[model samples]
Target chain A: MPEQLADTVDPANWTCPAPLRDQPVVVMGHGGGGALSAELMEQVFAPAYGNAVLTGLADSAVLELGSARLAFSTDSYVVRPLFFPGGSLGDLAVNGTVNDLAMSGATPAYLSAAFILEEGVELTVVDRIARAMGAAAEAAGVTVATGDTKVVETGHGDGVYVTTAGVGLVPDGVDIRPQRARPGDAVIVSGPIGLHGVAIMSVREGLEFGVEVSSDTAPLADLVAAVLAVTPDVHVLRDPTRGGLAASLNEIARASGTGVRLRERAIPVPDAVANACGFLGLDPLYVANEGRLVAFVPPAAAEEILAAMRAHPQGGGAALIGECVAEHPGMVVVSTGLGGTRVVDLPLGEQLPRIC
Target chain B: MPEQLADTVDPANWTCPAPLRDQPVVVMGHGGGGALSAELMEQVFAPAYGNAVLTGLADSAVLELGSARLAFSTDSYVVRPLFFPGGSLGDLAVNGTVNDLAMSGATPAYLSAAFILEEGVELTVVDRIARAMGAAAEAAGVTVATGDTKVVETGHGDGVYVTTAGVGLVPDGVDIRPQRARPGDAVIVSGPIGLHGVAIMSVREGLEFGVEVSSDTAPLADLVAAVLAVTPDVHVLRDPTRGGLAASLNEIARASGTGVRLRERAIPVPDAVANACGFLGLDPLYVANEGRLVAFVPPAAAEEILAAMRAHPQGGGAALIGECVAEHPGMVVVSTGLGGTRVVDLPLGEQLPRIC
Candidate 1:
């Protein structure tokens, strides 16, 4: 990091918004989807572009545009290695934004891709990435409609960074938002966790576990559509990405002002992922996953939704991992298999950066 | 430049798409929004992701999404020196996307901002930029609805690069596009040209041309609305941005299969801008302007629309500088004062890189 840039920032000039007054310069944590990232959104972006829809701060903003209900979302892919074990940055870029819209009960239709290319990256590499993106978009049933490209001087950027913005049509009569997670809701997770972060780390650090761990990067839009088919009001849905499951749970609890109680043993973590996390001294609960989703459904509809999700190929390992409770509002507590309970706080930063 | 990255590019791997068979690597000209930029879009991107709306290659893709007419556009701003004389990258990002939608005759509504921040950028600099963005969005009557942030490793990124994607509602009965320009249509300019490019060159090179030239980087949506009010049948509206007036004119001529003839004395060029360009061996017609636009109007309604544009403060310097002709289709010719005519070809690349 450049010390000169940090030296130029005066804390007093920030006007010190309450609870986040000390961050005089941006740290890697500010980009992690954890408490620091939330604070950045709340203190900086939320106030600057203050609007009801924006302040809602959902995975996707659901807008009602002139007789059309739309879900809009965006994601930037900055993974270290352009190509990973199970997926490249291309597929991740497509799946990440597509899942964000799916979480809002929308059928994603179109996307805008903007690329920032470093000056001397190989043209063949870009071509390969573009072809992967094309194939991914075809699989997801969306079009890469509009794009812009900018080239930065060499060494001033990583090879290429892609930012994708998407628009989709939200299903009628379905209103899903973070604030709708009530105390009587059942929280179910689709498949295993921690695969994506582990996969990226394996490639980046050149460390291999006994088994090759591949990223679980896939589109969950169809799975979401299945759940919505069973019941329109699914309460809250989120893909555990960047800061992972723990951070996602904490965000929903805070947004709904309710408590989330997770049965630790019920949460499914693949043996490979768990072993890798153990060896690296990282918590599986704080590791990211690209294709998995956590949904909060009313007690009466939980069974049907879980059944629907399990029937889908992407969610064959779906499990009822937890429930929302009224005991400790705005907190998440994990019930240990050892007959003890522990608070699961949001991580200060990601255990691994650029794991998305 | 990283020679290793360049060395990996095999020209044979590209398959040598017709017309663009030569360039093996992405050059700065590919992003210049001129012929090379268009060719890159036509050859590389269009073939990789083939779709109807994308192939149109309009300023903004007009879409019919669930009974709502929408215009989707995106732009990436990599302007060096983050802060310029009259504007920063913040407002440039906001205005650039807004103007793109305005060219499609859309009421600019919402924007998505994604920022790639270098690891050590100062918080104060980011704060100031964010504040300017907020003010610009307010002025343009649009909201920054969603955002994403990523951090690159130090030395692998510029201070910051912003990419904005915007969605707006296109007004009914307005079919403004590049292909709409036709023979005998009057070509009108909204304001003085070349100020933005000169302003950045002045700061980047530390040179002065006897007079300080400030960038005209304000949002032009209001001026567009004023023009559309006079006549909904305006042929085409385009903001002369990256490659300036000459490039935009050539693009329209090629798209509409017509020729453009401009009276040299009628084109508006600020004295300072002309002097600066002359000193730097740059053509005033090819230098960029942020807050300026060119319109193609039917001869019958040209006078009323020109009057309407001149009435707005942003368009106070509006003038009728040229006309579309059937002769020499796909070219732009300027008539000299001595009754001689010379053709103005699209530039191979930008005179100034990262000038926004």
Candidate 2:
């Protein structure tokens, strides 16, 4: 990892392809899942890994094998400060991918966990992480069926980095993706927003807002199932994780060719999170959340779906926040509480780095 | 990643559970897929993530989701030097996982790739790796369906690390596991061993054996399918990777409560790899191979299966190495080329570290 170390790899053997001239090197924003992340995928990954399922770029890929259809997803948790207030890296590792599959209306059944450990990491820490993953998978009613472990020399890794990939069963009648959003579809959020990002930031920056803010990193498969039980025709579902609510909305708008109009007043942001964001000059809508989900459904079934989500433990704060519109396609406009309309473009990168 | 850095985590929040008292801290051997690796799983991972499927400790887990029978597996590639003589990390990532599913008697259909990047790494290098993955997946007949990317601060990573998880369809009546290796089963290995381990070590140690030794890393799903075409009743299929041929044979012997008798003279070992291991004081028997597979099949169908395997491009070097015996259950004994018998116990760890 040090420059002085001599190794066989030249590190300059392969030059960047012509298409990647804009960014000769990778920046932090490239991993932000925002505009930069999109460009990276479109130019680099999507072109190299050309396939319909990957081209769609949804949270989870629905694949058909033989006579079965299943949802598969992958996520690597690289959150700074391995342990946060309400959760640890292990919690995010399991819940994040499970939630991705859940967002596709798939009943998450199994997960594959691969761990990259630093050479000198304490075994106790890894044990704790594994226990946390076990508990989370149990809560989500999924099995951690297969795994691989690799260790890098000290200073070459950030203690422990876990990449988990999961597979789930998608029901026959259910079809969901970001592109399913349509005009007039009502958008509802599962619960309070911005808790996860704020929690990581508070612990990272050592700034307290009088009250403790913990991450809302809980598994939401149950919440998703409850919502699906109410209606299988749900248009779209997204878990606002890395780039948060604004990013998800922007992607949906662009993919579906629909404009999104949000009622900022209806969006639920706890007072503590609001105060923290105010003090930090951060927008909660652009902040990340782990255990929350955004659902777009036909307006007719929105109320019932909202009711079902609210009844679930993971979605106690469900609220109807917006609706898809035909005007200003590929744009998201918010009607602020201050009685002004604001366009919410996807941030070039996430406000908080490594806030997963 | 430096200790002086101010972070929220204390790194001492959790204590090692009672069961892991033997190894107070994780070492490189825990990832070696040998004795230490097995101990970690049995003592730490298995207890925490308790499930029947996980307890089996197979290369891939076969699950029944609804009416679908599928195989799920995961692997992380942290091989140092990034690029090697014959292949790169990207090729290893895809082929490793695909071969795992194929060993489970499944047809690899899709893969999920997650990358952890070190900030400031060249995007061109990333593009090359992605292209390599695309080509490997194409050769393996699998789609790169879903993926995630995260970047850590410059010093917290080794340029690029890839973790790929794959899911594939398991044909009806196909059951393959290490525990299925029984007495009277013929042991056949596809292609030469030790090439991959020697290739990696040559680059890492700056050793040259007059002749170039390239890694024998290739996709083996088609070869596995060819074997299956001859017969689905094959007892065990193992793609010797991290722990190499010796480790795999030991595991199969222990798992099935049978003894493995090998004719060392018949086990294919290229002269270059043999000479390299000789100079390095390494055992070619414990060296790794990426594209090779060791099959345990009934003696009745061994010839036909061998013929089918030899007919495939990936299995041109296929040779019958040995057979399972009831004499020394849970042990492996090899008859050497020098007309002497040698007991091959699993190495406590691996001779080559971070090798695929």
Candidate 3:
């Protein structure tokens, strides 16, 4: 109503894609951790909390505090059917956050677990989830050091939603981030992709396709540590969780002002996952992966790092997927087995919501 | 089921108290941060995690990693009516977790925020809340370094729920924990109580009590730091939230294995808060105050710490409330104005749920 406040309240000034310009309410895509998610962060959160560390927009924000470098990250798991083929929400909450820290070449040391339990949920269920979290934390070699629990009125919340925040120590001489990707860096994936997303989808839809596709949800810290031990000069590391490899590549390309070229035959996607994606009319490249990570290493150290990764159990299926290029800066292109190249665009929204 | 698996699945051995024995499902009181909340943690979480750091059950866990002493804590804010009189859920999310770290005599540094948003909530609402969080972080001199966003289906969530985890640096020689209370320690409160709870209740009930009760939701890191500057030997510092001062005092008494005697007349309760509590049939002592803190200081250092606290704007109304006693260990008693002493037991649950 006031003259001075009119400019602050103008809706036209909000930066969003043309398709999303008229949208006034949040949609599933906004939380899909994709293009819309980026828009939300760039337009709303970035301006409000104008800080340099946050501007990096890495999976985990790396900070220097009192001569110590730390990697801090947070994730909320609201997966449907708390339990799935290979993992439960509890394990996902723990391993997911631990993996986020590992993506930054940090050794995750401690985690904080906060739960929102709906009223009337069975105590036995709570116990089961808590035990699963404990087991997962132990498996990841991280501790659930502190926590808080709250109950929402029935109907206001689902069974339970768990959010985990992790703190880790980044080793000296290691500088890994999205913006560190260089033009000649080799792109490598730690293991098979799309299994985690397809596994959740199978359970949700109650469709068993003869072969069960279990989630690839495991901690990647050991694998990352192995690679770092070989060489701390690794440029960038990212766990393709929500928007999958396509989004991760796009983010890296944009951040580093470089282009990406992927070899379709070299990308590791299990047969079961491929079949499931085919049946669901989805692309494996855009499906989420809980455990796998994408790393960019200089050509000189790529062979050693890849071998180090493959030696680890979690990275047994490692593959050289792509490489950064100067041809199409900020674009990703994949050469199909048929000798044709297709542009791999970031998914606008996740095909599977709450997959993590 | 197999015989061995059946034994593992049995819930009969869960260690809940007799009063909570019949609670087959979660109740609002279980998350009230009171007796039921303590029961939930002890019965469900503690047994499952089985870790020493969690056994301490302090507001924040003090960790020694590398050469740095760190304090880590977390909380989830599901406050109703995102905007209240004095503070919104946005600021509350930031200040609440910051205060938790401060309670451990740490200088709050970095925070991670995770949001669970319901589909269809207005984007403007989210932006407003995010802006408020930015402002609050600035006021507290902490950074929202990293965050996560997830959306639940409509009707499954209430607008937006926020969870924040904070990490801070604890100075050497500062040993603050609930069990640090000594027999001769003096109890002090930073400011008035009960406004935060009543403020939420007033907004929820749509009642106008002539005077609008504003929440005392504020950051207490500076106040706690000031006291530590005066004396790092200050025994305990607690931000009375959830079940409020009564719950905090009871927790301290039990942890220290000592009795506490309170001078009811010395406890500071804002006249408006007291009037609101009286009208609503609530005890001001048991109502929440987000901004205030309770300190247990040695008899010799009490004056110096109290004076230091009073010098800070947030602790301007500081008062000496009570003293820890050797009689009737693990109990708290208050001397009433009517020449009678009354036991102050922790409430079974909060009178108001979702009061942040």
Model 3 chain B worst lDDT window (10 residues): B1-10
Task: Evaluate all candidate structures by whole-model CA lDDT and list the values in order.
Answer: 0.84, 0.87, 0.87
Ten contiguous residues minimizing lDDT sum, candidate 3 chain A? A1-10
lDDT tens digits, residues B272-323, model 2? 9889977877788889899899999999999998899888899888999999
What does DockQ give for each predicted structure?
A: 0.59, 0.68, 0.69
RMSD, each candidate, Å?
5.7, 8.0, 6.7
Order the numbered candidates by DockQ, best leading. 3, 2, 1
The residue-by-residue lDDT of candidate 3 on A1-356, one tens digit each, is 01111222222232345666588888888888877787878888878776777768688988887778989999999998899988899999999999999999999999999999999999888888999999999999998999988899999899989999999999999999988988999999999999889889999999887799888999999999999998899999999988889889988988887889999999998999888877878888889999999999998888988899899999999999889998877777899999998777766667878887
The DockQ score of candidate 1 comes to 0.59
Model 3: per-residue Cα lDDT at residue B253? 86
lDDT of 2 by residue, A1-356 (tens): 01111223222122223444465787787788877787778788888887767768689999887777899999999898899999999899999999999989999999998999998899889999999999988988999999999988888898899999999989889999989999999999999999999999999999999899999999988888888789889889999988889889988988888999999999999998999988987788889999999999999999899889878888899999999999988888899889988777776667878887
Q: What DockQ does model 2 achieve?
A: 0.68
**Which has the better DockQ: candidate 1, or candidate 2?**
2
Candidate 3 residue lDDT tens string, B182-229: 899999999888889989989999976779999999999999989988
The residue-by-residue lDDT of candidate 1 on A88-177, one tens digit each, is 998998999999999898999889888888776777777777777888899899999898888778888788788999999998898988
What local lDDT does model 1 show for residue B268?
93
